[model samples]
Target: MIKIISCILLVFASTYSFACKDPLYKDKYQITNFSGYSDVIVARIITSKHNDDEMYSPLMSFDAAVLEKIKGALTPNQVIHVSAKIEDPRAACPLYFKENSTYLLLLERQEGELQISRFSFPIESNNEHFSSYLSQVKSGINIH
Candidate 1:
């Protein structure tokens, strides 16, 4: 009876999933962190390519037209390419992006290319506070 109960407890504990992150809100730390990004831009995803070869996690590649350049060397109307790996839905932060979706992304320059790492969170274009975050970062008055 003890072994059976322990097994059941282990199964339940191992199956517990943490809630995913909500990209709508940015605290003081988030604002500061976004400011440190190499490039911060608001762009509309013109195209998206999905790759599922890496097992459960799905990879997404995007080509977006730069609409606003809050910070960075990106020019207006330029096509910025970015890619993200949508992790398991049960993970704390699984980023989902769609073609034609607008997002405020923190892009880092790597090897002469812009890339989005697994830890980056792309804010939705519709987020009301998107502008606020940009302003804070741009003015360098964001929370420390």
Candidate 2:
């Protein structure tokens, strides 16, 4: 147990210096056409699975239940596949979603697969911006 805890601490400690903190939006990844994303949805992650592959590197694929739809083809209560690239070996990034946590995601659809936008990051429910996002959506304003 001690060894396992030590390893966990080591992994996080090593990554923390280089990793992007959760729910942070750096302006470098900002999108100009923020209002024109093809698929934007507010969803709650239901399940999470980790995959490490050559094409995707280490990525997290989540099953999320739609709580609200901001645009595009999704409907409330629908489940969608959400995937995020985790470039730990190079960038020290890890999976961003937590099970049962809600997120506002901007997406791009590619050949029937829904992918999180390169310009955006999932806004986790606990993020400082989460409430502002919901408020903007409620008032029909630009989200971020």
What are the RMSD figures for all models against the true structure? 4.3, 7.9
Model 1 steric clash pairs: none
- Evaluated at residue 60, the lDDT of candidate 1 is 67
Q: How far off is residue 71 in model 1, in Å? A: 1.4
Clashes of 1: 0
Stretches of candidate 2 above 4 Å error? Answer: 1-32, 52-57, 85-92, 135-144
With candidate 1 superimposed using the best TM-score fit, by how many Å does residue 144's alpha carbon deviate from the native? 18
lDDT, residue 12, candidate 2: 93
What would you estimate as the lDDT of candidate 1? Answer: 0.67
The true-structure Cα RMSD of candidate 1 reads 4.3
Q: Runs in model 1 with CA error above 4 Å?
A: 17-29, 34-36, 53-56, 85-92, 141-144
On the 0 to 100 scale, the lDDT of residue 84 in model 1 is: 65
User: What are the lDDT scores of the predictions, listed in order?
Assistant: 0.67, 0.67
